[model samples]
Target: MRERAVQRQDRLLSLVRRRGSARVTDLADQLGVSPVTVRRDVEALTGRGLLDRVHGSVSWPRRRDRPGGGRGPDAEDLVLGLLAPSATYYFADVIRGAHEAAAPAGARLVLRICDYRPAEDPARAAGLLAAGAEGLLVAPGWRGPGDQAAYSDWIAELPVPVVLLERSVPPGGPLAGLDRVCSDHTHGVLLALRHLTGQGHAAPLLVARADSPTALAVREGYAAALRALGVRGPRPVIGSVPADRDPEGFERAVQELRSAVSSGAATAALVHNDVDAIRMVQRLAELGVRVPRDLALVAYDDEVAALADTPLTAVAPPKREVGRQAARLLLERLRERAEGAGGGGTDRGMGGGAGVVPAAGAGSVPDADPAAEPAPRRHVTLLPTLRVRASCGAGAGTGGGATG
Candidate 1:
């Protein structure tokens, strides 16, 4: 029965390729089966990457030239584009999430690193789309008004959906309608602050890249915690480090912190993200500063920080979950398109062809809508609990020296 069903689906697809569209009733009559059977066949075939059903109609899948000069079916072949600035452990995890999502759906994932040049993104996006990418996952290197405009334009022109990971865009931007998934930095920061304060430390320094939304949120969370404790003298000294120029940039940050410590400005320091946090700890150690005694430290993104010598007390986000969600959403969109083509009575069995329209669904897929505004005074902040490791004093409950 399964073999016969497969044969029937193949025949229907062949007809769709030739006729450009196939009606469900026509397909049922020709196959000598009920329309219900045809529909089920079409759905199964669609899931298998053989056909696309659109708005009560079916059409043959489009064919595109393969890179090696042979023609290939477009329905089963898809390009999933990924954009990032530089290769880091953090970005790598995000990419892994996206790939895990795309693999089961029979889509190919392509990666292009922008190297911090936001200007180059649009051209890269266009080239990928031209190569037949069905969707995109972008991790913008930096944020600015002009960069936002370019990203918006690129998204508007793409033939499929674009999912932004770990970055926020401007309000009323072109990509505003699209989906986004980001770490709940505000809540993560609060958790870090509470951990430090609970350790009986006050006047900790908050270090980050200046003016970034994530940095700002961390600073705000720290300030709120400080205020709640009624500790007032001078504000927690917030400093910015550059993500583009590392080593030297980090060295400069170390010097600044040394100066702060000398002047009695800050005792403990909270590094913005894990990357910087790890670097900060290393640099401080090189300068003969002991962690948790001379300067207690906490960082964000526990995954990356765990790789450090101290195994940092950092915030962990639902990273793999984010990737799985995005992948599921894109697959849903593809499936919807398939169903629409099948029901239309057009060519249900063939790949891409004329008379097939893409289908859009409400943001029902997991993490499909990243920009859905949070409720008033309430944010969907993923909590980052203290990992209680050797890096912070919580490990052995000792207020002095590093733990083993």
Candidate 2:
């Protein structure tokens, strides 16, 4: 059953790469299999990062080369596990980067949506881990104490290494030992603030979620930058608006902002993210206010914000680099495990075993071989850069332009 599944997956990948797109019915007919079988194959391959399905059409990832045409690893079932907080565009981009990094190492990437639930079953994630997942990548959802503890315990007990994305565990905590690849939110906010400052804006409002770490970091950075620039006045009227709440709630929040603006509490705003920023823009327009002329705006996460109608100016993080770093760490752990299983040379510096070397000679000889030494594990914290566009005071073709 496993071998047949593998063969079908390989053939499906070949078809997807050759044709650029494949339909389930066409794939089933070409492969001499039932439509149900083809659907399963497509689902499995999609989970494994071999293909992307959109509106009933399946296509190979644009960044990846055709199957059997590259020296990198094939898109195998190497996915150990995944944790998705929400199906937001930011999370999707992060997942895409992870898949790109893992696919080259013959690893599959399985996504599990947490959906802002209070708690998640560790056992639910265990099955994938047991099925040869070398590591786990977690994007935690709306967290409560119980949920946080449950996730921390799961990470502690899991045999494989783990990487946390866009979130942080408690400081001086055991879970902190695990690898982390996250956007530098402090720097991200600094970039946004600096852009606003350069545009001759002062006392710009900062809209944020009250208790979110991402929000807190952004607030801290904004405050610090303001203090450094010798600016002050009512602390920019910070608000705790829940973007994840109901659609009406967001509308209500915007109404409140409009009221505040009418009362002269704020002039310009720096939103926590593009979603909220764009929503705010739309709401202001509906309220008969002009953007940039009446109010300047900036946001975080460039991809989603840039796609907005006004093409938002935002701080962009090294998203793909974060994914690549996390995958590379997990792959190192996997290679260590493979070396241990095969009883190969233990000179890889993982410190898993005592190797076979003459006792006296072992003491006399240097253990570090330039070629045999493991590559240094990298802990990368990437700062965000400002992508100035038409959304802010800078018009299109201004000195500051969209970042790659």
TM-score of each: 0.63, 0.67
> What TM-score does structure 1 among the candidates reach?
0.63
Best by TM-score: 2
Residue-wise lDDT of candidate 2 within 172-256, one digit each (tens)? 4545545577887777776676667666666677776544446666776777767766778444545656556767767776776
lDDT of 1 by residue, 124-208 (tens): 6654453345567766655543555554454544555556666655544454444566666656666666666667777567777
Global lDDT for candidate 2?
0.64
Off by over 4 Å in 2: 1-77, 142-150, 210-213, 240-244, 247-252, 263-265, 340-378, 395-398, 402-404
Model 1 segments more than 4 A misplaced: 1-75, 143-146, 149-151, 211-237, 240-249, 262-264, 340-386, 395-404
lDDT of 1 at 282: 77
Instruction: Report how far residue 151 has shifted in candidate 1, in Å.
Output: 4.5
In model 1, what is the error at residue 73, expressed in angstroms? 14
